[model samples]
Each structure stands twice: as structure tokens, then as C-alpha cells.
Target: MDFYTVLSRYYDLVFQKNKKALSMIKHLVEIDDHTSLLDLGAGTGEEAIDLAFEGYHVIAADLNED
Candidate 1:
């Protein structure tokens, strides 16, 4: 398995389940329906997934993108 694969599995340990990570990003990203976002280190896609759900055009990225 690659780094992200392992990283994904342990995501909750690295960042807690109720970690306010989403809140932090939600504040930083000023979103519009047409807005585009690139989420680096989008582990397990938590922030990116939330942003997409909020209707922003989100592109989830990782250093492991090969």
C-alpha cells in the first residue's frame, strides 16, 4: 500500500474524529457556488468532502498523486 493508503486508514488517529479541522477550513475557504478549491494533504478527504458537500468545486490533492 502507498503512503496515502496507510495514511487514510489512520486518519482518525492523526486527526481526531470530531477534530475541528473542517471548521478551520470552512472558515478559511470563502466559498461560492462557482468557487474552486484545491485541498492539499486531503487525508481521507474529510475537508475536501465537506467543502464539496457545501457546493464548492473542490479538487482534493496529495503529495502521493502519481
Candidate 2:
């Protein structure tokens, strides 16, 4: 496996969502019918999940496909 593939497995253990960033994004976007966001390099998609939970359309992708 490659470095990112290995890192994907332990990503959640080593990192958690950045609450401040999440808040800032929400504050800036102000979810609406047309509101959408893309989270590139979104390892484990924790941030995307958070935004999605708040009813924002979010697309998350990562280099590591595992």
C-alpha cells in the first residue's frame, strides 16, 4: 500500500474535525437551496460529514481510495 493508503486507515485516530473551520464555513455559506461545497483531499470526510449533517450539499474526495 502507498503512504496515503496507510494513512487513511489511521487518519481518524490521528485527527479530528476542525471545529473552527467548520463554523467559519457554515457562517460564510449560510446554507440555502443553492448552497453547495466541495471538499478536496477530504481524508475520512469528517468535515464533509459535518457539513452534510447541517443540510449542506457536500462532495468529498480523497487521493486514497481505500
Candidate 3:
């Protein structure tokens, strides 16, 4: 298996605190339905998923496929 594949299995655990950070960022930024986000180097797509849930169109790009 590749490194990213193994890392993906535990990415959430490693970045559990990122949810709070993302929330803070959301509060600091004003995003509307028309806003589209490009999450470069997105790993495991956690942030992208959260942003999408918040109604923003998110494009998550990463070189690794896990």
C-alpha cells in the first residue's frame, strides 16, 4: 500500500482539532452560495467535505489517491 493510503486511515484522528480551526475560519470569512473554493493539496478531503456542507462548492485536489 502507498503512504497516503495508510495515512488516510488515520488522517481524521491526526487532525481531529482541525474541525475547530475550520469553524473559526468559517466565522472569519463570509462565503455565499456563489462562492467556490479550491482546496489545493487537500488530504483525505476533510476540509473540503466541511466546506461543501456549509454550502460552498469545493474542489479538492491532491496528488495522492487514498
lDDT of each: 0.72, 0.90, 0.80
| Model number with the top TM-score | 2
lDDT tens digits by residue: candidate 1, 12-31: 57875434866776778788
- Models 1 onward score TM values of 0.60, 0.92, 0.71
* Residue-level lDDT tens digits of model 3 in 1-66: 887788888987886647786888688767875678788888878888988888778899988777
Model 2 weakest 10-residue run by lDDT: 1-10
Candidate 3 at 38: error in angstroms? Answer: 1.0
* Positional deviation of residue 13's Cα in model 2 after best superposition, in angstroms: 1.2
lDDT of 2 at 20: 96
Worst 10 residues of 1 by lDDT: 16-25
Per-residue CA lDDT of model 2 for 1-66, tens digit only, reads 788777777899888888999989988888889988999989889999989999999999987787
Order the numbered candidates by lDDT, best leading.
Answer: 2, 3, 1
Query: Relative to the unseen true structure, what is the C-alpha lDDT of residue 18 in candidate 2, on a scale of 0 to 100?
Result: 86
TM-score computed on alpha carbons, candidate 3: 0.71
Flag regions of model 2 displaced more than 4 Å: none
